[model samples]
Target: MTLPITTTAQVRQSLLDRHEIALLDVREEDPFGQGHPLFAANLPLGRIELDIRSRVPRLDTPIVVYDNGEGLARTAGERLRAIGYTQVSLLQDGLRGWREAGGELFIDVNVPSKSFGELVESQRHTPSLSAEEVKRLLDSSADVVVLDARRFDEYQTMSIPGGTSTPGAELVLRARAQAPNPATQIIVNCAGRTRSIIGTQSLVNAGIPNPVAALRNGTIGWTLAGFALEHGASRRAGTASDPQRAEAAVAARAVADRADVRRADTARLAGFLAESARTTYRFDVRSPEEYLQGHVPGFRNAPGGQLVQETDVSAPVRGARIVLADDDGVRANMSASWLAQMGWEVWVLDGLTADSFSERAPAPPALPAPSRPVQWIAPRALADALAREAPGTTAIIDLTTSANHVKRHIPGAWFVLRTDLPQALARIPRARRYVLTCGSSLLAQYAVDEIAQATGAQVLVLDGGNQAWADAGLPVEAGEQRLASPRTDRYRRPYEGTDNPREAMQAYLDWEFGLVEQLGRDGTHGFRVI
Candidate 1:
């Protein structure tokens, strides 16, 4: 069947014009990972028939599918037609065709958001003072505050010789308290660009009276510029009053004065819980490790930094009330302020702890049982399938980040980031069978589950994930691309070996626990938590 194909120029123009179109790349993930058009969703062809409908609710929505060549397009088109999708079309000649036609292709670089942050730093021309600049300022006795916008752990790990730990979001709220004098110049930085750009921008955006600029490229840039970062443990924890508690106190005061913040006592909180049936999103904004150990009932683990960084990807619903659970109020309050600024109805759930409500709160949700009807294949059988079908027919999908997939992956495997799975199914060739793998078996199982739920595709999981694949003595690829840094080029202080990693860890934990408690306390009142 001759399917409708959209050209690169047309796709670019559509994006430029802000037209309502969903760009679907239907290729095995590895090739898709090598590069793809920006904002293109990946839904591998094998799963297109099932998953596309869920993501694109309207059958009439313009859905453009593309593969490496014409063969996949035809197969995908046929499947869409069989599924009764009237508006389904293909990308002419696939991605190669798009590029051949002078269309722009975007590299699926890891840390694009972090990179975009660097661009913001460049664009805003946020200031940075080198050692020489600092020396001059100090010599002149200038009123300049060198604020380290990284975590307290990082500040202790390494910071500008005289900088104080203010973290990022808190810079704006605590600026008055920390620095006091509005005339003082504020220099904010993280280990690298993200926090620095974000921190400097936050203060400037908040209309701080002081001049603010991020240290260019952060500490790495500083080092490259022949400046030195200090590396002694900080004498004390950079303690600040908890914003939620402060806000609550302010609200309490308003009860007597002009009512600004509303205070909800236990009775009010209980009543609010009884009255509301809205879908509340409870996040345990603690480390995944901590979450795996023990967390509040019904709360999903979402690290605070990652939660802030990937809010759109994580929670698509704009109006959902988000309740953040942390051990203490600091991180939760910091996260709440950012979310609130972004127009989310966010609240810090305070006070819950492993000790305080262990038995009182509901039990943790039960883990879903494995329900695969297909018997596990033997290693030899899997090897024979790979030998026979891998070269031309079978597509191995490593549902990991492109960077990790590129670094080291199953030989002949394609990269399909979990985020792009929906689009891959819509655009990749469906004639081939698929084997899903990830860093671990759990993620592989997750991919299989998502695919099964979306489409009744005959997909199989790599039993042991990447480890199993390696253990099977299957071919593995390795390259420098596989190595990923625990830290970004941007400034972020390491928490390890700091004078008080435990104390810092405890503080963060307390903040996250407090947040969960606060959310349960708030329930569905006038304030939305998300």
Candidate 2:
């Protein structure tokens, strides 16, 4: 049980001394997405006692963890020191001591924001287009539009022939409502190359006079230029009340005040929500149906190009204090100028509106979660106990990944891994209402108290798992039908499922063009190419 360890050359010299280290792998998001290192962060050993204090909210910064030796880095370094984590360790020989110390391994799940958007398009040569120069400016009807910036379900999964969605921090307030003719142009695109080079350098760092670019390496360079894309499209970006929404809210508040970004106001945003040892967050970045029709009050909605492409899923506290919000000052100053170029201590809230909401509503939907208080069953009582399949009165089980149990579950529920329920309770046939579920049962109530202390089983957790059985219209059943477990925890990622194989998308863009020489030999990523 002796924990303190480290040295993949001191986590590559504490990310080359820019400092704040997380580097956690703790194995389980599909084998931490089949490889590790480029600033590793998965954090999965069955939700590390429920995502380590909001994913390491500074319990003395340095963490290490790592696994691939199977004995999960000394049980995730004794569960990050029994959940207090005042600097835990253990990597030294995990993932084979980071490839025998030469380091470099990255694959999938936000490899440091996709290798810092391929090192910010190899240092700012960021403008782009090329799918035959945006299909000859849409076959010469010119005055372009395009947009997409990944996530409207990845711009309706594969777009381009006319693009639209507008996700990444809403490209300077929805690219002036999708190109309101400042002699048009725009472009954007994602699904490869970090939200289209941070959504066309977030409308060229918010100076947006409509002439941004980035489609070049997106939709995987329009499927390596053979082109075609468009499945499901459904164009988007429509309401920031365009006509260049007040000059893109004054050039996105002068690029969030030249990236110094502060402006919380309201008495320093009520002393940053009463500090209490610093785990701030407050987000808004508009559009989850405009944060469910009204927002502001202690924010939460995180849309601003998927909050800078999932800042470790919305402020995983890499030194917290994020504020942001947006009654349009060009989307919380272009998402607080890319979360203050990703070092984050960002701000922008100077008066959010719809008159700063939250008098009543806001029940668990402003995302960036942290609530965990499970134990339930209602998706119509697990659809009347799975229509009385009554085999031991019920047996559900699921616990989530195996690629979301082959992309949907419940019809016959078998999946496992709440840390493999004590050898998965002998492949779960012995039930007495062992319900549990995932995809939002919040790790099925931590897999029903570890399958009720490993086999006292009366488990029941399915309240909103399988998205409350597909929002209660019920009836879901996809492949890998009912396996007690074999999907090796999670990895088939290669930027996740959709036609991949253009040699696995050009070997995932040649491993993001060798991640800036492996962040210059894993010299720790405090990454600042902005």
Candidate 3:
């Protein structure tokens, strides 16, 4: 099918006008991170069938997919069409066309949100304390509270010597409880700059009485400054007192009002959800634990700090309406205020009682059925086949993320990207029968026909994939034991691990420092700070 062509100029204009248009880069994370349009969200061709429905909920919403001479865009567009999308188009000539038309190409994922953070820091002049300075305060036992404005898991990984996990959304709400004394100093830190800036600014915006500043460069700077980090930290912010909650709600509401964030009651939320023409994302911007306890039926859990940092992953459909909910009024409003400033049509769900949250446990992902019938084998049966046949006779291909594959996977499984099957299959030894599995077996099920057609071998899916194998007390292997494809599914963040070279860490910081200028050059980011 011939997909309509969307010009670079049109896409740029749509972004500038704040129109609802999803600019997608249908390439793997590594390539997409190398270069892409400012607002282009990476939805790899392999994941389109599994994630497109949720990321771009409104099938009729305009979407333009592109690739860099990879020829994946046309296939992606066709796939979108096959899945009931009405308005799918291709970028004229793909990535090359964008560059030729002078469109700004940004490196790294979440460029839009990262650049917006740089802009916010530049305009607001958010206060910060150097790692050395913060260290001195800690050594002297100063009256200061260090708040790690990152996810709990990230905080548990590595944190400042004395820091508590109070994610960005909870900063304003929990700051009072952590530092009740008005004279106590508060320091916000994340792995890197964006969250630190945003978290510190959030406190300043909420009119927190205590002095607030970001830990400059966060843990990266601390490590570079020869400071030791504490691992497996469990410190976390507790619930706010009644008076603290009331004060925080008032302050957060004022900030949201200033940012022009809208408020909606249950009736209004129903109207937004019922609107078929618009894509509305209902999210509970609280921690995953809180979400699993109980949450609004339709709302998905997207922790507020990570949601702001990774908007592209949470809401790939640019210009979609976002409604945030939290039983504690403060988290939703605080998060909504930032979304509003980022040019999102965001709303805070008001008037939520304890009874409002009745649903428990994580919701199953919404997915479409496989294009064709798929043959399956039970985990034990597959285990027996491996023992019964020659080592290479029954080859196993794992289509899960490389990181997860390295952590735990079926024994002797060759990790391969589903989209890279054509090339990857040639590398793996020819086998009489092949087995495919992913985290849930869903992705593997979708690839059964493709692998069978390419290799001319009988293809069968592991009944429940890697998760089930582990669940049934099956032995699994770890590390990059076998790989048919490169580990490029996810771009490695410079600030994620401890082994990063000093040069790379410094280079990443330099890049972030220049994002303000990049934002100006792009001229499509409609970011405004109140």
Candidate 4:
């Protein structure tokens, strides 16, 4: 079937004119991270069916798929069409075409958001403190609070000594409570630079009287400076008083107004939802713990800081309208302010009450059921079969993300991408019986038909998947030992982990510092700093 082609120039102009568009690189994360157009989102060909609906909710939303001569774009386009995506197209000549058309290629993920953070820092001259300075302050017992502006899980893994888990949106709302005295200093940090810069700037923008500064280069700088980080830390921000919340709401609204973010009441939000021509994202920008207790119906929970740091992942469709909600009013306005400056048509939902949040739990993601029924093998039964059968007679194919596969899997399962089942079948040793499993076996169930077709052997799915194996007290293995596919599903972040090459970490920082210049060259990012 012939597919429409979107020229590189047209894609650029769409971005420049604030028209909704999803430029997708239909390659795995590793390759996509090596190089892609600034606004392009990496939605691998293997995951298109699983992720496209959420990423670009509007079936008729204009989408252009491309790959670097890997021949995946056409197949991706066809799959998208089959899944009811009505306006799918191919990028002319794929990645090479964009390069040839004088479009700038960016390395790493979330280029648009990261570059916008750099632009914010450049335009606003966001204040920052070096790791050494922060260390000295800690040593001196100065009146300061180090706020780690990352998710609680990330903060638990590692954090600055005495640092509290005050994520980005929570910064403005909680800073006053964390350091009630204006004389106390506040240093905000993240695993890397984006959240650090954004979090620190958020407090400044909200007119926090405390002297605020980002931990320059964030935790990476702390590690490089030979400082020891605390692990298993669980310190979290305390609830703000009614007075503090009221004060924060006022300050945050001013910041949002300065950034030109629009306000939408419940009626207006319903109207935005009814508009079929545009895709609108409804998000409750609050802590997950609070979100689970109760949240607005039809709104997903995305913490404010993470939403800004990973906009491509959270809302891939560029120029889509986003409506944010929070009962306190501080988080929504603060998060919307950043989103608006990042070129999104964003609004903060106002006139909310405790009664507005009626949903009590997170909604499950929509997924297609298994194409056909298949036999199921209990985890213990499978373990016994593996022990009793001859070597290579029973094989397990795992379809989890490469990262999760590396973390844990059945002792002898072969990690494989669902899309590469045919190719992978050829590589694995011949077996009389095959079993498929993933994190929960939901995705594996979808692949039962393909594997059964190719092998013609008795195919069974592991009941409850890998999780059940662990729960059943069965043995499992970690590390990448048995692999039928390359582990390219995830691109390792240079800023994560402690053992990364010093040069690589320094290179990452250098790259961020240069993003402003790159943005200037591209001229398509309609970012503004308030």
Candidate 5:
């Protein structure tokens, strides 16, 4: 199972040459969040069989997979080959070799994006208003509008007092509508720092006349400052009026011109994509609902503000050409302007007719049916089997992911990695029958025979996996229990969910706060402030 090996030095050289390289970490997110090289993408082994093409896209792109000391890279490479990826390699000696070679390792998930946000703050002194200052303004009834620059659902989760949900790219198009008076002060906030700075700067870049500022450090900072966040907020910035839209377009076009952002018609976009020497990503910089309603043929939905904040996650190839599309030019232009400063070859796609968006984009591609036939049992049948059998006779093994296993799974399913199943079967109580399940039963189907051979048990794949079980009005339980495998596939992100401890939250902020210095020391990112 040994594949061609790539050293950390070679990976660093590729970066210096500005080559498109995906340093993929094959472990789950939990370990990935602990530490990794700055540019490494977390592509856990469990999902590699499903998401390779969509995530990496190019078959020939150089990819180096690592897993610290887990020994999962070679197995992952084999899976990549099954899916037709040609340029896959293992990191020599894993993460330890990376350190020995003097490569800098960073902690936390989405490090590239978070570090970039800090770089933006360092480069451009994006204006801000402390929670205390904002509180005083609110108490005095000042003419100010607080806008939450996160998704509507996120805004509803926790928002500043009286803040409207005006997610990223919409800042320019809807700010005027939210605050009609240019003389009035405007405040923008997000959960933490990235969206707040990016949102406030978007207004400044568009030459908006209002005195705008980010609610300093967003809701996290507010909480840190002893201010209560407003939950279940319903305020939103709806579609802009004709005059406001026209005005926003003019400002955006001007900013785009300043950023030297080129405009590409459909033909030009196609031509750029046709060039084999470079990679071109075309995305629609609009809300997901708008994109879902209708979108162009090949463009993916990448809401503008989040796109800028998560460039590495969205577009791993640093020097690739990115084409952004929007019905109105405001979102695309403003987003491209910031990306240009961040050293990307970015463009705005143009000449879209009403017909361009007449159809909705397709759902994400599904995993193909497994090549080898495996036994299948419907959710109801499986439920009945669990009740009919003695307590430990039937082992219900779930391969969905440690994260999902913790969230919810089939009531008593033991979460196990497919790779670990062969080695782990001997330890579990001998069972006469076994049932396998995952997000979809697609992957579980392939593992049925392997489990049967390893454990000498009659194995069956759950017909529709957990999704179908949940759809059938079945109750599911949640916990880190009945584990046949370690929870190593998914990282616990500090900036991820709402329930992070204060120490982890503060530590994450401090890590981000110190990133500009790290970026300076590493000297890889060619970021500039415009």
Candidate 6:
């Protein structure tokens, strides 16, 4: 007999009711890392059978599986039934449906505090502070501690007058160190809303005695309000310790921990890969340009900073073993430290490389190609189509971030953040065709690829990305003006893709095997995978 499918509304209400429900997401690591719903555990469909027993524990517990509507939910549901799970169910429309129902999704910046930071930001509001009020505060010269919640580098680049760099997580821990007086009014600011809101709230949540409020909409708002700003000291020195010394200190501290860091030889890694069959993720801790140049065939590109910031999004598999792939140990080891802190069973594959294995060595199976049609339209043709096309029946997507989307974009096009694309697709009429655009041709190509694979909708990439459109001298919009904000809130899925047990196991094994070959080819030197 087939299990029942639950609507997103039903699942959401269940969570509110605090029912004994287990929410499971089954997507690949890279996409899942993008975003997912809060409190939903990731169990990629490929490894559902192996992990369900442990994650849910109670066989009869209500289990709901979902994806971005790529038929992964049905696939996962079937797997659960085969494993004798009696109360398993599928999320009616997967992530897309949940989002259409207005469910919140989250980005996977791996640090729990960072995730909490986002939550604090989402709950933020711009409290009124008029020019007169500002004048009064300045005139009074009261003890107002202005904290810059952005990275140290960003603080140096620019900041509000009298602001000092405190970073995000450190806001609460080091608040007193910076502002010792309990009577001081603590004010946090970042480039924009996210960090400032989180930073201010962190102090409030920690029960600090001072009055804390995020500078309304952060530094942008401050400048807009005609408030003076200041920049930090230039060309600051590097962190006191060397990379190796820092790593050694981190590892030494984890000696007695269950999540201690471990390095695997080629043989050990190969055995792990041989034993597992699932979507295992291998992240190349490098820049996007480096990744595009080709490091490992299947490895995803996740820069170390973003990786650590959004760990939950990238690797949601709580118990699934993680393998870090890097040319050196510094990054890999540092990333591993963060993951270990998050309770992942992580390992670094030592001595792995593409050339180390024999030419005939078996390659991992390729991911199933996206099933959608791929259309390549020249920039001139696309501009012509947009000008003449019926606006309501067709949608143009600027898949870049808000900042880039605002700089210059196609006329009448909507800004579809990469994190919100799936849900945005659901809200858009399926009858309409979609035109996808990005800063460059490569990103647009990838967006088109994923949409086609995940949805049956007719989609096209602006052939040369935005550059092509600009080169053709078509109409463009520019300036700091804000686009209409999306009606639906951003979806945040913590473990949608990365938490698949089967995939995690497979990834771990592959890294182990791959590392062995790499070590033999290039004697381990300036390399780390975290």
Best by lDDT: 3
Error of 4 at 240 (Å): 0.9
Per-residue lDDT, model 6, residue 145, is 69
Tens digit of lDDT per residue, candidate 2, span 1-530?
68788788766765565455677777677777777776577777777766676556556667777788777678768766765667787877788878877887866776777777777788888888777888888989888888877778766766877777877877777676667667788788776778888878878877667688887777776777787787787878787665568878988888778878888777887886666555676777777876777776646677887777767755544556777777768888877776677667787877645556653346443122322345587888768756777556777888777777788887878888766566767876776657787887775775565576666756677777888779888888889857776776766655544677788877887878887778767655666654
TM-scores, one per candidate: 0.47, 0.34, 0.98, 0.96, 0.93, 0.47
Ranking by lDDT: 3, 4, 5, 2, 6, 1
Query: For each candidate, what is the lDDT?
Result: 0.55, 0.73, 0.91, 0.90, 0.82, 0.56
Error of 3 at 165 (Å): 0.8
- The residue-level lDDT of candidate 1 at 364 comes to 39
lDDT score, residue 459, model 6? 81
For residues 40-102, what per-residue lDDT tens digits would candidate 6 score against the true structure? Answer: 666655444434553444456677888886767786787677566677898887888877877
Over the stretch 132-204, how does candidate 1's per-residue lDDT look in tens digits?
Answer: 6664675587887778776567678788777777755446446656656777877776655567766776565
What's the lDDT of the predicted structure labeled candidate 2? 0.73
Question: Which ranges in model 4 have alpha carbons more than 4 Å from their true place?
Answer: 369-375, 419-422
lDDT head-to-head 2 vs 3, winner: 3
- Model 1 clashes, total count: 55
Candidate 5: lDDT of 199?
A: 87
67-161 in candidate 5: lDDT tens per residue? Answer: 88877888888888777778889888889999888888888776676787788778778999998999999989999999999888888877888
Name the candidate, 1 or 4, with the larger TM-score value.
4
Root-mean-square deviation per candidate: 13.0, 22.1, 1.2, 1.7, 2.4, 15.1
